[model samples]
Every structure is written in structure tokens, then in C-alpha cells.
Target: MSSSIDSQTAAQLQEILVGADDAVEFLSGLAGMAAAAVSEAAGDTIECAITLKLHRRPVTAAGSSARAIELDHVEQALGDGPCIMALREMSTVLVVDVSLDARWPLYMQKLLDVNIHSTLGVPLEISGGAGAALNFFATRPDAFSPDVYEKAEAFAAAASNTLQLSVRLRTVQGRADDLEAALESRTAINLACGVIMAQNRCSQEEAMAILTKVSGNRNRKLRDVAKELIEQLSGSPVRTHFDT
Candidate 1:
């Protein structure tokens, strides 16, 4: 590993990252690229972790590979760790001297257990809220240099912009899902209301009241009651009702 990357290489990397189209793909690429660049520049091996938050919580590690899943498990099991702190504080936190830092005793112990000595964490900015964190780890003490910090901060800024775009994408996707679900529910409820109107010769309000009463009596969701009504109207098997 070399202790420096030529300015040309750094410029090329920046250009590629800026020109990338997909936010998630860009962030993923930047993580690996930045880690490699820094490791080469520092003449040491490094490990990095990027955690993205969704719906105000860190998503489960279901879709990740073993190493990532293990990291997520560590954070969950430890109850307090660098990732949690980074997410909470919304700033970079460097544990250059983890052995001397006494702020998080339990977390530091877990880090030591895992043989993680030095760490640097930077928050991934999310518009409208606190976002995610990208953390880098080194086995050796005092692995980060002043130049490393400067370049790492610049890379982190680019990564943060991509992460913010991801947040927006997720929000839009969530809204789309919500709208689709609402549409389906409204369609089912309307069908059920129409069945009631025809069968009981009642007005829309009366049908809704009847469904509400049935829902309360059965301790069931309104959607369930409405679905049952629609199923009956469509000649499906009707569920038997009983007194609570």
C-alpha cells in the first residue's frame, strides 16, 4: 500500500461518483472506493460499515451478507455502540484512542472483544431528519492521518448527498405503497357498502354504521368486516357470526 494517491486518481474518482445516476448504487460504490483509497493511502488494512435508517429505525440485516449481518447483530446485542452514537449525534466521532476513552464503557468493551481498536464515524445526512452513518475501523492504533481525515471528510460529503437522495426515494416509495393500500381498502369498503345498501335497502351512512357496530361487536378491524361483506356479496363462503 502506498501512503499517497496521485491527484489525478482522486479527481477521476470524484468525477465518476458525481456522474453516477443511482443513489443507492452510488453510495455502495463510494463506500468500497473510499475504503480502498484510504487503506492504500494509509498503508494499512481497514474495515468499513455503512448503516442506513428507514422509517426512523435501522432496518433489519435480512438482505445483507454475513459480515454485515454480524455487525448489525453486534450493535443490537451490545445495546450501545459506535453505530448508535453516530446515529444519535449526527457528527463525526473518532475513537483514535479507544483504550483511553471512557464515555461508553460497555460499548468499548465489546469493541475490544471484537479486536476493533481505532474507528472513525461520519453521519450520512438525510433531508428532513437525522440520517445514517458510515464507520471505518482499523486494527492498528492511530491509523488515521491528518490528510486521511481531510480526504475522508470530502468523500463522506459526497456519500451523504447520495444517502439523502436514498431517503427521499424511500419516502416516495413508502408513500406510493400507502396510496396503493388506501386505494385497495377504499375499493373493498365501497363494495361492502354497496352490498349493504342493496341487501338491507339502507343509505350509505346506515350501512357504514351497521358495519361499525359489527366491527365493534366482533373486536375486528373494519377492513376485515368490509372484506367479509364483499366476499359474501361475491357469492364466497360467509363467516358465521356469534355473540361476544
Candidate 2:
């Protein structure tokens, strides 16, 4: 991916960033920006889409137009497109005329069916995040010139950087949530073991063993079993010393 955008696009991108750039839904704006950028650089651009691979699945996170999003779904379902090849090749792939493009025959046919004759896919740099690409579609054959393609590449790079930051933000937030959940699970299990220890007058190891058996017998997760034990004993009058 190119590292920097031209001054004009940089200014426009900055405007987009300043306008309601939410972490999770930011891709929609970025995809729109990509299509608008290419359109501004060269006319005849019909649609644009941004694809982000999550858990090894391609999702059309955002699009400049509905048709762009539809084409993305078609590519995902069939597992073929210039966009997929761009990501796989880690480079730009262009289908000058869908009817004449023989590399991805099925994908080309679908494009023709949609009245999208030309397509350009630019690989993006997600930076330790999901694989991504920016795709543009045109109704006319060879609608995008080499210069326009280069300009769109710069926009793709910008989208990549912004997307990477958003993805990393989500990752950090997810890790924090996971840590909190793990801590809660640990506390629950420890409390359950302590309760078992008091009731059975057994060692901590023996209490854990008993808990494990209950978990297995009930076909439940250890944490679920632990939580149930604590809940069950909470309102009991003859409760053990698990209040600590």
C-alpha cells in the first residue's frame, strides 16, 4: 500500500476523520470516501466497497453504494473476484472488461450480470489485523485509467491505516473484557471451592476435585457449576462459610 495520499485527498480524509469517526462503524465512512475519491479523480465510477476479513471470512463492512455491497457478497459467496486475488497476491488487480477477463471466469460473469464491466481492487495494509481491500466498480469497460488507479491506491492506504487503528482499538477492548471475565470466573471457582472445603471438611484439592466431578456429571462448564453452587447457597439459612 502506498504510504501517503495527495494533498487534496489528505484534506478530504482529514475532514472525514473529524466527522463522527466511530471505531466500530468507521469502515462505512472509509469505503464511501474511497469511492468518492476515485470518482473525484476520474469520473464513470459507479460503486465502491471495502472488504475486511474477520475469522478468515470476507465481510463487506461498508460500501459507497448498494450495488457495490451486493457485488462484494457475490464474490464472498463464490470465493472468487479481483478483490480476493488482490489480497492473495498482495497487489492491485484490475479487470478491464469483465467479459474479456478470463482469470476469474465466474466472478467476471457475475460482474457482467450486474452491469459492472470494469473493476479495480487495491490491497490494503491492515497491519497485524484482518486482511483488507478497497474495490471500485465501473459500468464502462476500462473506465479507470492508470493514473486514477494509482490515486485510488493512495486512498486505500489511508483507509488501511484508519482501519488498523479501529481494529486494534477493538482488540484492546476485547482483551480487557476477556481479562475481566477470567478474573470473575476465577473468583467464582475459588469461592465455590472454599464453600465445598467448609461443608465437606476437606482440603482445597479435594474440594476442587468434587467441583470437577459435579461439572462433569452435570455436563456444564466449570464456571457454570461454580456459579450455581454459590447462587444456591447464597439464600440458605444453613449456609457454609463461603461468605468470605
Candidate 3:
């Protein structure tokens, strides 16, 4: 039997997806939608999830149900599963029957304990960042036949494109946040240096030298040292040369 989504559901899914503002949430929700579509076609109960590894951190992006999310968590704890492997190998892994799959005995046993017997993982390639994968779960063995796989593969392709955009968006946002942090660090360091200059009657260069020395000696980041100085001087009388 061919598993495929109806036209109406596809339209609604598109509308729902376009509203998400972040890549993580969007992909997560997309995972749920894809699972629903495939399950509907298969006419069986199925669960779905999305996992993405970005910046070397792996997160469960979304799940078709709470159980789906929980399943992914189990795999993460064990550091083994078809989904995690799929991302690492950059390929698809299908455990047609989880209960008997020898590849990940522990991981398979965990799934079986939860009454989940089938799983499929498909990796997604996002340019300029760590990759991701879509994971699905089912109550029965061999839940994802070739027809179901084909439908999911197509959905995964579309999801990959969206995930790429989301990754890029986050990358840009991350850079902006870093820049802002650097600016704040500079401000903090300068404020601390100015305070020291007044209190010790020293030149700006001397104040900076003292700060750098303290930072190295204490094995603390320069910003951390600067922050400590600010805290200590928070309520003290203003000691800048211009203070009267």
C-alpha cells in the first residue's frame, strides 16, 4: 500500500510551519506533522521526532507526541540509537523491528520496554553547521515499509531545506550576540580601568597592565576580573579624576 498525505493536510501543515520563528521549534513541529502524515497514510499509530546537532550540541527539536520525545531522550542517555547513529553516519537507519535489532541491543531493549518496536532515522544536511535527523517510532514491527519510507524521504527533503534556513538564521543571530557581548566586555574593562586610574592616580596604560596581570594571576577571564572590580566599586564613592 502506498503511504502519502492528502492535499488538504499538506496545505494546513505548510500554513502552520510558516508561523514558527525559530529553526528548532519549526523543525520540531515539522517532525510531528510529517509523522502524522505518514501514519495517516499507513493507517496505523505512529510517533515521530526531530533531533538536530548544532554547534556540537544535540537536542530533540520536536516530537509527534510526548512518548516520541521520551524515546529520543532514552537514546541520548545511552549515547546510542538509530537517530543518533543516523546523524553521525550521515545516512538513514531503519530498525524494521526494534525488539530484534542486534545493532543497538540496549537501545532496542529500551524501545521495546516502552512498547515501541519499529524506528527509522533519516539525516539532514545543513550547510555551515552540525547536521540533524528525523526519527519515527511505531508500536508494530516493520511499520515503515518502502511506501512509507518514500513518503517520509520526500518530507525529509523539504524539512532539510527549512532546517538549513533555520541554522543560517541562528548562526547570524549567534554572531550578533557574540559581538554584543564583546562590546559589553570592552565597556566593563574600560569602566574598571577608569576606576583604578583614579583610585591609584595611574595612567590608563598602567591600569590596563594591572588588570591584565590580575586576570592572568587569578586564572580568570579579563571580563570576569572586570566584573568583580565593578561589583566592588558599585557603591563606593566615584573616584574618577573628574569626581569632586
Candidate 4:
């Protein structure tokens, strides 16, 4: 189905994608916008929550509201729900009425207890073995009419590209952070080795050996030991050029 997102909504989603500080923030904004759009289209109050499963990472969830977040957590904690099923199956899962749905008894009961009588789960198309879904909750039974389903599906489709871009940006940022940390660690070790060489009148290799021995004896990370040794000499923590 074609995306139901209007040009204005598309612009808003793009704004969230570029303006958000990270993937989590982007997902939160997406959930809020999705909830608002779906609620308007359906002419009913609908709450949204997004579930994300990235490679080698624990599943994460974001919601449009506190109650929506709490409900998503309830599904995550129980380990079974329309949203989970949708993610697992990579298809839409609709519970027209929590009272009639028998697929997830425990989860449905939990939703019923909280007066959420209907739910719709739409899988998002994400690349690189990552999985995601947009989940909607409503208080009345059969809240997800055919038109609502179309709108939800369209929103999910339109969101998939931006979400993929956000995930890639997050991955790149993580790599940059790791590289910066490694550079800082290497700088500290080099500076400490210089100090040791100057004080002990030894070669660079001997100074490095001494530092390694101290690190092993102290049972600390090599970087931590190097940082501590440098701090002792300067009376402050080591700062590399990157720190500025």
C-alpha cells in the first residue's frame, strides 16, 4: 500500500530524523508523530509505541506517552504480544478485540486489565538484519478499522527509510566515539611512557615494559594505569589534542 503520510508529515519526519541527537531520540519523535497522525486519521485516541531490535543489542522500545511506554514494557516483560508477533513474523498483527483474541492470552489479559481493548502491529522494513515495528493501542474494541489499517501501514512504510538512516547514523557515531576513546587511550600511554623514560633514563621499550608490568601488578586496564601515572606527574587527568 502507498504511504498515507502527507507532505507536511513527511517533512516533519525528516526534521525529526536530521534534528534528533540519536536513534533513540528519533524513534521517540517518530512514535509521537505517528500517534498523533493515526489518532487524527482514525478519529479516535490512539497511542503508539515503537519496538526496535538491532544486531547484538537488547530490544528497545519508545512510546508516544508514559502509558504507552508502560504498556509496551508490559509486552516486553511478558515476552508475547501482537507487537512481538509482528516483529517475529514480519507482518501486520491486528487484535480487533482483546476479549476475542486468543493468540496471546497473558498479554491480552494484561491489556484488558488496563482498558486497552484493541491493538495493531505493523512491521517496518529495516535493513541489516535489524527489526522494528510500530504498535498502536486503543481503548475500544475493533478500533482499527480498514481505513485505520491502511493509514498505519502507510505510515510505517514511509517511516522505514528515515528509521534506517537514523540507525546508520547511530552506528557511525558509535564507531567515531570508539575511535576517539582509543586515540585518547593511546595518547595517555605514550605520554606516560615518555614520563617514565625521562625519569628512569631508559629507552622507550624499557619504559613501555615498566608500564605494562605496573599495569599487570595493579590489576587495572593498561589505559587506566597509564592515565593514573600521568595524573600523578601533572596533578590532573591526561588530555589529548582530541579533547579540545
Candidate 5:
């Protein structure tokens, strides 16, 4: 039986590796793939959550909808859970048969209250830094046997790759957004410069200086000042230059 299980786990790990390439439509979808793998392996309802501290704000990604949301709230409000422990320890923590396990009295009780009888969660980390936890929860007491743990570790490895990719993708997306914002600001400042040049009959550089002077004096943003100028030209005091 053990040998068969190992063979099954190996096959599943291979499938995960194949399915998890670089073609992720969204971060949530990657997490869903993980939860689905665990469910198929454990033959029960499984939930997985990935939590990371990005830019000093805690961001959570979950594969199962309800369990993920519940866990998110629990971590935010209580600040203590398996996910936190996983990130803190940077190691896998499996609590098989939670009803019988006495570790973490408060959280364990909370799990029982939610009808989660067994759990096997492993911390998902990136390069020794705190990343996220690949958490699996089930409704059966003996859901996580040794075989399950071995299979889960293999699954976690695949999920960890997805997690790392998601992180890099997000970083790239964020930088792209910043670059777009900077370009927009530059365009707005230039538009305002043109408006000032036309209104004051000054050179382009002189108009920019006026804008700077006015912005500094009023402690307002250059774009805001430019927006106000355009609105003034339009003869609409209530008109806003920017959407915000």
C-alpha cells in the first residue's frame, strides 16, 4: 500500500509540474490549482491559502473560496494561525487528526469549531525569507496519514514554484504601473506647461517655472495646478482637471 501510494504521489507531482508552467492568467487561479491538487490527493474538501507581506501590507491568496476567506479574517483579526506559524518557522507543520492533537489549543479549538478535523500545512517560502504557507485542511480525523504528508510535500514544491512566479509577476506588474503613472504625470505637466505658455505668452521653460512656483507656493501638486488651469480655461470652476 505504501509503495502504491508513493507511486501515486510521484505521478501527481509530475502532473503538477507540467500543469504549472509560466502561463498563469491570474494569481488566484494558481492557488486554485494547488487546492484542487490537494483535494484530489486527499479525496476530501481541501483548502489552501497563500499569504505574503508585500510592501508592508499583508496580501493573502487562497485556493478554496470559503476556507480561504475565513482564514484571512482569522489571521487579520487574531494574528495567530497555522499560516503565521508556517511563515515564521519556514518549515512544514502538519497536525494530523486535530481533534486528538493538543498543540495550539486556541487555534485547534477554532478548527474543531469550523468542523476541520485534520490538517497538513507547509510553509511556502522564497529564498529563506517569509513568503506564504501552503495550507491543507480536511474534514476527516485521519485524513492526513504519512503517505498524505509525503504527497503534500511534493505538491507543495510545485505550489512553491507557482508562488515564486506569482511574486515576480506581481513585482513586474507593480513596476509597470509605477512607470505608467510617471508617464501620465509627465504628460499632464507638459499639457499644463502648454496651457501656461499660451495664457502668459511666456516661453515653454518660463511657463514650467511659473507652474513650479505656483505649486510650491500653494503646496499643491503640479498636475493639480495644471488641471485647475485647464478648468479655468474651460470657464468651469466646478470642473475637475483629474479624475480623482
Candidate 6:
């Protein structure tokens, strides 16, 4: 297959990235699209699953269907399979016939039990110490011919940049959420401290010390204790501008 992505598939991948609400949704869409692409190329039904790893640990998995998801999970649970191997080796791993592939005995048995006889695992290039792969499953032996393999590899290559963008967006969103939560917690704690100072006729530092003591005695997080105190005093839940 050519290294360059065809225009239509590239547009579809771009659409998946732009329209997805989060990383999970984006991965699911990507899996479905990958399945469709390979199926179209091979003229057979193929299921796809995507596995993502960060720091050499599995971060998430998505599938084109429920069965695809289950198969991927089985591989993860067993800790060995073509997909896992592909991610680890950063190369394509193909099992032309699951029954005959003795490399992953347990995984082959599991796939045979599910009536899936062939599989292809193609790694996606991603930066930031992140790794990803597209896993394709078929119901017949040697379903992934050379042409099909080439097509799948091409699709994975084309989708790599989009996957990287999705991951970066998710990381940014997570950091923003953490920062927002910290700000809200600080606001609640300050308000709670003010209430304590007024009620006890104490200094701000004294109020903070009292609050900390109460938090430790209750064995609860400082933020939780602060929020509860404010809620009890106001007879309503605390609401920050970030709420809703």
C-alpha cells in the first residue's frame, strides 16, 4: 500500500476526530472505521479493536462491536496476543490461522472458541511515549491476504496523527479539569474558614488550624470537610461558578 492516505478515508478520519466528544468516543469511531475499511478491501466481514498504551501500560481499548471488545479484553487478561505483541514490538503481527499459530496458544484457543480464525495487528505511530494498535479479526482462515494486510497497515498509518491529536486533547482536558477542581476546593475552604472565624471569634490562621484538626479527626479529605461545613451552615449545597 502507498504511504499516503486516500482523500476519502483521510476526510472520514478527520471527521471522526473533530466530531468526537472525548477520547473514548474517538477511539470507538476509529475502530468502527478501521473495520469498515478492511472489510471493504477484503470483501469479507472484519471486526476491529483499538488498544492504547501509555508508558507501556494499557490505557484503553475500543472495538467495532461487542465481540471485538470481548476478544480484545481476553487478550489483555491473558497478557499475550498478536495485538499486545504488536504494541510491544512496534511492528505488525499477523496470525493467518489462529488454529495453527502456536505462538499464543491460550489466545488462539480463545479466538477459536469465538469462531474467529485469523487476525492482524498493526501498530500505530504515536508520540509522547504512547503506543497504539489496530486489531483486525476475521471468521475464516487466512482471511487477511497480502493485499488486505497492506490496506490495513495503510489505514493505521493514516489514522496515527488523528489518534495522537485525540490523546493530546484528552490530556489537556484532564489537566484543565484538575485545575478547576483545585480552584473550587480552595474557594470552598476559604469560605468555610471565614465562617469558622466569625463563629469562633478567631483569627484566620486559627480557623484554618481548627478546620484541619476537624478534617483529621473525621478522617475525611480537607476539601470534603470544608464543603460539608459550608453546606451545613448555609442549609444548601455549595455551588461554584463551574457548576453546571
Predicted structure with the largest lDDT when compared to the true one: 6
Q: Which structure is stronger by lDDT: 5 or 6?
A: 6
As for lDDT, the candidate ahead, 1 or 2, is 2
Candidate 2: residue 45 Cα off by (Å):
4.2
lDDT-sorted candidate list, best first: 6, 4, 3, 2, 5, 1
Q: Residues 45-142, candidate 6, lDDT per residue (tens digit)?
A: 99999998876776447999999999999998888799999999999999999988889899999999999999999999998788999989999999
Which residue ranges in model 2 land beyond 4 Å of their true spot? 1-24, 54-59, 99-102, 235-244
What digit string (tens of lDDT, one per residue) describes model 2 on residues 210-230?
Answer: 999999999999988897888
Tens digit of per-residue lDDT, candidate 3, span 1-244: 2234444445555565568776556766787787887897567977888887868867787788899999888888788789998999988899998767899888888898999989999888879867888888989999898988876776777666766666676788899778777777887889999988999999999999999999999999998898789878795422323223
Q: Candidate 1, residues 1-244: lDDT per residue as tens digits? A: 2234444445555554567675555555656666776677578876666666666776322211334346545765665566667777777777886687786777666667777677776676778665677667767777777776666666666656655665676689789778766766677777788888898999999989988899999999887889777786677633332214
Q: Using TM-score as the measure, which candidate wins?
A: 4
Pairs with steric clashes in candidate 3 = none
RMSD of 6: 3.2
Give the TM-scores of the predictions, in the order they appear.
Answer: 0.65, 0.77, 0.67, 0.85, 0.71, 0.80
True-structure RMSD, every candidate: 8.3, 5.3, 6.4, 2.8, 6.7, 3.2
lDDT tens digits by residue: candidate 5, 45-85: 67766666555445565455677657655664566666666
Per-candidate count of clashing residue pairs (backbone under 3 Å): 0, 0, 0, 0, 0, 0
Error of 1 at 187 (Å): 1.5
Q: Give the per-residue lDDT digits (tens) of candidate 4, residues 53-95.
A: 7663326478998878888888888887898889988899999
lDDT values for all models: 0.66, 0.79, 0.80, 0.87, 0.68, 0.90
Write down the TM-score for model 5. Answer: 0.71
lDDT of 6 at 182: 89
Question: How big is the positional error of residue 9 in model 1, measured in Å on the Cα after superposition?
Answer: 12
Winner of 2 and 6 under TM-score: 6
Model 5 alpha-carbon drift over 4 Å, by segment: 1-28, 54-60, 63-65, 127-130, 194-205, 227-244
Better of 1 and 4 by lDDT: 4
Q: Cα miss at 145, model 3 (Å)?
A: 1.1
Once superposed on the true structure, which residue ranges of model 6 sit more than 4 Å away at CA? 1-7, 18-24, 54-60, 97-102, 109-117, 127-129, 241-244
